[model samples]
Target: METVMNRIVSPQAWKDLADRLGVDEACLKAVAEVESSGGGFMRPPSQLPKVLFEGHVFHRQTQGRFDASHPELSYPHWDRSKYSGSVAGEWKRLDAACALDRGAAFASASWGAFQIMGFNFAMCGFDDIEAFVAAHKQSAEAQLAAFSSFIRRPGLLDALRNKDWKGFAAAYNGLGFAKNSYDTKLATAYLRFGGRSP
Candidate 1:
């Protein structure tokens, strides 16, 4: 699979995503910029999608699959505080999570430029989690396809199309979206990408 980091966002990719989501090109471009710096990658070298592993989610997803004696397979000893804002730290935690269960591990982390959770594979038009990961490894085009599908499934496309950053962020970025200022940042990015200021 090609590394997502080096993939370029062609004009047609934006146009396609906008068309699929029934939104303006600028809206798609702004989200792309804010989510993955317009390229769907974290830092260089790894070229993997930026991911934050939710240990709680991992435990919930993998519960009852393994015995307590298998400490590595259990989440009880996992220290969420050990993982911070760095991608490297997140990767380490992700590796440990994968050891417990690959499906649950992948489902616990958000993927690609859109940062959609793996648990949302079905909502994102993927047949399953494995399929979602395969698409993510393909290219930015695939990632945008997943993003568009995710927004449509949750009926969040309207918020984006109307430039309702707060509504969009609330639905897309979760309730704590304000703490990250995702709404404001997206608004700023929209203006930068030629969208009308909101």
Candidate 2:
């Protein structure tokens, strides 16, 4: 449903960002690949940037006020079943949550390729969710830049550079990371991207 999804980042941009992040280009590529299948938007027709709504996050953002009335969109705990299981479906969830609480809704979802949470706008160098989402709509380069800034804020860059897949996954993906095998997937993708073992 989005009209602005014409984003194509060049290989040079990736390399340059990697250089600035002090990590191999392949390392960055691997995270991108594993994060959103190497693309920042869904397929045609609804090229909205990729996102995953977190009901638990919404609950926290709104202080659990809507948890009982809108358990589907706001829950006290993380529940995988709450997911719509597709890029478009996530937007639907976000839209519904937005109707209840716009700011909380925006802050509850992870946005773009790196899947950075909207609550992390400050960490990603944005003053607010509107600016964060605007950057996501601008270009994939903005998304990549946000990812770079995000990792550095939490000091995940060293974990990524050193190939500490487990540590990186645990920190970046949260508690359910191991359940999804994110560490192994990241390692496999990193190696596939020609990242040397560290």
Candidate 3:
């Protein structure tokens, strides 16, 4: 069987990063395991792909072209710039893709192992996947920052600080129906990581 330690890219590196982030090492490691599976191109499918493909997903809306059929808020995945198009076709294609692109069965554009959604990259600071990955690879510090953004950016720390690992995990995973199922595993991992008695 594979050991949990084997999954982690750099444990000491993550420890140092945890020091900088002001969170406990055990907590941070748990968060990392739950968030990015020990870092380096390792994220769950839904979250990461959407972050990575957000640009292409949004481009279907055409920022300056003229088209028909696209409407603001017409589709769940519609770009915020839906109204920026000169015509409706830009909006139409975006709408179609939104309707058809359910759960990444077709797009197949997952870039980073973390599978950060494409839409969030620009607003999150990184310009592209290559830059984000190259800078973060084998570097626990960078991965820590990235995971911090992924978790805390959505108010995850508020939940985590309250011993709400499930809530934090759910938030990190974007699941509205998160439960406390993973709490035991997380707690066990914490004790082990913290040099505490189990």
TM-score of each: 0.84, 0.93, 0.47
| lDDT score of residue 76 within candidate 3 | 40
The stretch of ten residues in a row with the least summed lDDT in candidate 2 is: 1-10
How does model 3 score by TM-score? 0.47
Q: Which stretches of candidate 1 lie over 4 Å from their true place?
A: 1-6, 42-44, 64-82
The local lDDT score (0 to 100) that residue 67 gets in candidate 3 is 26
For each candidate, the alpha-carbon lDDT, in order, equals: 0.77, 0.86, 0.45
For candidate 1, what is the lDDT?
0.77
Per-residue lDDT of model 2, residues 1-198, tens digit only: 224435666788898998888888887888888989888887766547898999999999999999889989998988989999998899999999999999889889988888889999999999899999989877788899888789994448888888888888888988679998999999899889887776
Shift of residue 68 alpha carbon in model 1, Å: 8.0
What range of 10 consecutive residues in model 1 has the weakest lDDT sum? 69-78
Return the lDDT, model 3, position 8. 46
- Reference-based lDDT, residue 104, model 3: 31
Per-residue CA lDDT of candidate 3, range 134-164, in tens?
4444343454455556555546666655556
Q: Is candidate 2 or candidate 3 better by TM-score?
A: 2
Choose 1 or 3, whichever is better by lDDT.
1
Alpha-carbon shift of residue 188 in model 2 (angstroms): 0.3
